[model samples]
Target chain A: MDSVTALGLVAAVLTTGSFLPQAIKTWKTKSTKDVSIVMYLLLCTGIILWTAYGFLIGSIPVIAANVVSFIFTFAILALKIKYK
Target chain B: MDSVTALGLVAAVLTTGSFLPQAIKTWKTKSTKDVSIVMYLLLCTGIILWTAYGFLIGSIPVIAANVVSFIFTFAILALKIKYK
Candidate 1:
């Protein structure tokens, strides 16, 4: 891949991976008090749209990043609901 | 704008706007206990890189979204540090 794509890939990895710790924390602590339900709700909606946008644009990095982000954010959202 | 770009703009708005509630919650509650610093740290770093990627790719939506996201994520990060 070109450098720009590489940069995007790296950015994608960092952004998507960032959610892991949040998910893990919520899971381990079983505390969703500080986590905003609205944020995740909006986030999941946004991620779905982003995925759609990615497919429409044929951008692999965007699609891949949002897909993984959806998994992580969705888990956090589920935990928020379950624990809330 | 084209439909795909319009979709991206909407996605950008949603994702960027999602952080407001979290930042507000953290600010009002002054509780970072449930919030993961690592996540925000990673998110901030990732967002910065995403901004760079946006500039490189010349995507207005990506650039605008990531810029606003960086502000919110950075604010959250600051709050996390302050409260922790």
Candidate 2:
């Protein structure tokens, strides 16, 4: 792929992967006291829209990043609700 | 602008705006025990790359979203570090 696309892919991977730590932490600790549920709620909704936007724009990086992000964020949100 | 762009803008707003709540919560609570420091570190780094990617792609939505996201995430990271 082109360098720009490569850059976007890298960015996508980093941003998408960033959520994993939070999800794992919450899972391991089972503590959501300091975690903001509102943030995850809006984040999940936003990610779904971001996925739709990616599809609309035909951007593979955007679509891939957001789909994975949704999974991670959804898990965190579920944990937040369960532990809240 | 076009509908797809509009949708992307909306998606950008939601995702970027989502961080505000977390930042505010951290600031108010001054508690980072439940928050994952690694997550914010990764997120801030990823956001910087995402902003660069946005510039490379010439996407206004991406640029705007990441810029705002960076601010919020960075603030949270700072707070996390300070409280931790």
DockQ of each: 0.88, 0.84
**Candidate 1 vs. truth: CA RMSD?**
0.9
List native contact recovery per candidate, as a fraction of 1: 0.87, 0.81
TM-score (C-alpha) between model 2 and the true structure: 0.96
Model 2 per-residue lDDT tens digits across residues A1-84: 899877777777888999999999999999999999999999999899989988988987778889999999999999999998
**Which pairs clash in the backbone of model 1?**
none
**Alpha-carbon lDDT, every model:** 0.93, 0.90
Best by TM-score: 1
lDDT winner among the candidates?
Answer: 1
lDDT of 1 by residue, B54-78 (tens): 8988887779889999999999999
How many steric overlaps are in each model, in order? 0, 0
Residue A1's lDDT in candidate 2: 85
The residue-level lDDT of candidate 1 at A48 comes to 100
